[model samples]
Target: MSDTAHEDPELIQLLTPEGELREHPDYPLDLSHEEMRGLYRDLVLVRRIDTEAVALQRVGELGLWASLLGQEAAQVGSGRALRSNDMAFPSYRDHGVAWCRGVDHKALLALYRGVTNGGWDPAEHGFHLYTIVIGTQALHATGYAMGIQRDGAVGEDGSAVITYFGDGATSQGDTNEAFNYAAVNNAPVVFFCQNNQWAISEPLERQSRVPIYRRAAGFGFPGVRLDGNDVFASLAVTRSALQHAREGQGPTLIEAFTYRMGAHTTNDDPTRYRVSAELEEWRLKDPIARLHAFLTREGIADEAFLKGVEAEAEELGESVRRDCRELPEPDPLDIFHEVYAEPHVHIDRQRAEFADYLASFEDAGAEGGR
Candidate 1:
């Protein structure tokens, strides 16, 4: 597919780069001034959290970090659209969604810090633990959606599930299987793919012959491509998709056409494969900047409000840095505690053996000191 998918005439876009608002026939956004301001706040704070995490990794505080530097709007917009009962299966980089789901931002740092496999209970926030294995969450989300259907949870107030993945995941067998399963079962699920141009240095050309959204048609469902940089577009399209699923309309595929402005993770360097010019081009379409422009041009927010948001972002950065450094390291034995809910003979015997081995080292140390 062409990299210019974002420029496709059929793509849904509510706000233009110049801060202009356009109307779409199907997905219409009706937001009050306060709601617009709130979206801007979410964009700013999400960016701050990402930046802070990146800084922590560079300083050796975190083992690694996945920077969601440019895709803040895609995450925050769709995340805020979800109802309390709705479940979200997210990739490792969807910290912006975690924020909207009421997850403590500091908890995110623990995973990169190697303090825990998962930071919080998935049930507590209706958000699953970040899945590191690419495209696996798509299958998990589909299975969960099928469960919803079996439970007869398909109505106006029924629940739905949204699975977040990247463009690279489209090539995985797991994702394709999920597409097939969801289509056959008519599961109440939305497949939200953040097509951020480069999937860790391999461009979109390597992943699909046609647009990612177009693949949904082969699976027997409706697909829509939207300007992922536009928060209004993301929110509007996601809300419509979820509603369709809840009303027994089956699955809808949403391809969010955006770009990743930073390295895929703290470990990889984009400078090696991608050119600086490409980065500069996407910078002009920065999600946060356009939204700020719209808010300013329409007089929906004053300079005072913008400045206040900046101040809040700075405070959030400071808080994350401090709390991340203060997090207590987990004990080695705690790994066994989280392995299973119920006890098994093999696990108990292994734990006992490990305990004895640790005790032997302590005994040796004591005798040597004496």
Candidate 2:
């Protein structure tokens, strides 16, 4: 193990639970009134997207949906911190990050609805498709960072990559290997882990004995923990980390100490593993409430402004519902279209076989009618 003294001993916080502003020595966020309100808007809109998706899943429009219910600030803060040149590799539940990357929120429904393998072109938006495999995106991110390094992309105009994972991924071997590779190669990647306490049903204590951020020390890089519910802390810390990586500094591990207020997915039940009291406690620290409180307290926004945000959120929810229902189901043969970049004889043969199989079913139905 490496020395823990190098990392912040406690969680880095900026905005308190009660909406009071506090100063952090290392991560200071100075934002204008407009910026503050903009952050608030992002939080509300993202939460609306999540809620709509969950409802869609419940109504049989989607096969499944991973809820990012309480981790909005962590996703939005780090997402807003990225520059256009920066690449992001996200886990399955990072709908908020997809929104920040300018991806059509409705398009994301295609994956859960089983209409498409991936909803958007990653290269177009600098955001990779959601990775469902545990901790694999970490390796992909590290490899991409290495490519950036090899391409001489490091300095002011260069790019960095940020990979988002959860506390559950910390226990995976791929994640550990990625950490080693990034550390040794000095790859410009930020490992942003949202330690939302529960990984499915397992608690964080089952994943690691120590705070997840301190794991970076053993990898020969700096690691810091922050109040993932506080957008100010998340944005400031992620911005600083991205800058450090772009300037050729090694990887940094940012463990966002958050809570998963909902079930792990549309399938799991939180009541089975966790307590109601824990949920109530985190609800009091809700990300949107804190930011709204700060906005109200600071006189940055009035009742009208707050009401407008609620109206916008409602509009967004409606839009998502309409768009999700409108999405066309893909043709069964469409799956073979992207299996190869260059045509391969074997895949062509397989596609033909599948087409013949479908035609046979149609032929049988016609003969029976005759």
Candidate 3:
């Protein structure tokens, strides 16, 4: 490892891939047995939802969908670490985090179905709309943190913000700007980058010469790399980072070292660019399976509980598939609804022209009624 990599500070992780609990000096979670099980449950349920959504796409209900397949731990761990008072900004692939924030699974399907821009209100769940344009949410999260600071909503301990982006997004200028703004202004936000090894077909080597966490120090903040496959490690690191931000310590960067176990999306094919050996290696580190092993071996959980959880997962998957299949097509007039708060002549004219175009599709006699 480079001296630079060693010199940069990072949080402690509680568990390794072997499913053994390790100690971290900087970050230790004070979790109860129930709390641990709850975290496990969240990961399991979200994974099922993720699987069902992909199946929905395959069956022709969705326009496009992004899979969170191997990323269950990264999303669920970080999502559970957040406080209800804290806000989150996520990319479209963060359905797991959205689930953690109380977003209805059906609401997420609305985006893939092209029925609505995004159906949920951010204020209601502290989850911003799903951003397809990568890295833009980082800025929005930073700005929201600034608002929290200004509003005196941040207590003496400080309030926190977390934003999600992919490995490919790290190269965007907006991401760098977000880091600068968060660092200089001392905004209380955590920039959580899920480096799933591949940015579509591009590999991590193409995006960075050094580890992603090392980039944090360049912007005058702390950063850490967690064993993203270990739910305990991800949760421990994120919980501590959120605490750091809330305590007015400014922003921290978390580069979750994970892999994309499946295709980037249903539209993608991993076989085109990568080898099967890599996928086979990562499969051995399946986050949920590792945690279940840990729980059973440690006497924290057992086979009956595991079977029950699996049954619940199946039920959740069925619900997701059914709801997604029945989602309504968006109303045609909704296209012009939120574009402007106040009306303008050009917008009004354009809307009128659009309405006329739609009316043209109707029979000549029926068009007048519309």
Candidate that would win on lDDT: 1
Q: Residue-wise lDDT of candidate 1 within 1-370, one digit each (tens)? A: 3455356887889988778888888888888999999999999999999999999999999999999998998999999889999999999999999999999987899998999856899888989999999999999999999999899987889999999999999999999999999999999999999999888889988878898999999999999999899999999999999999999999999999998989999999899999888888888888999999898999999999999999999999999999899989987777778678898888888888988999999999999999
Greater-lDDT candidate between 1 and 3 = 1
Off by over 4 Å in 3: 1-12, 156-158, 341-349, 365-370
Q: How do the candidates rank by TM-score, highest first?
A: 1, 2, 3
CA lDDT of every candidate? 0.92, 0.91, 0.85
Which of the numbered candidates is closest to the native, going by highest TM-score? 1
In lDDT terms, how accurate is model 2? 0.91
* Candidate 3 TM-score, true structure as reference: 0.92
**TM-score for every candidate vs. truth?**
0.97, 0.96, 0.92
* Clash counts for the predictions, in order: 0, 0, 1
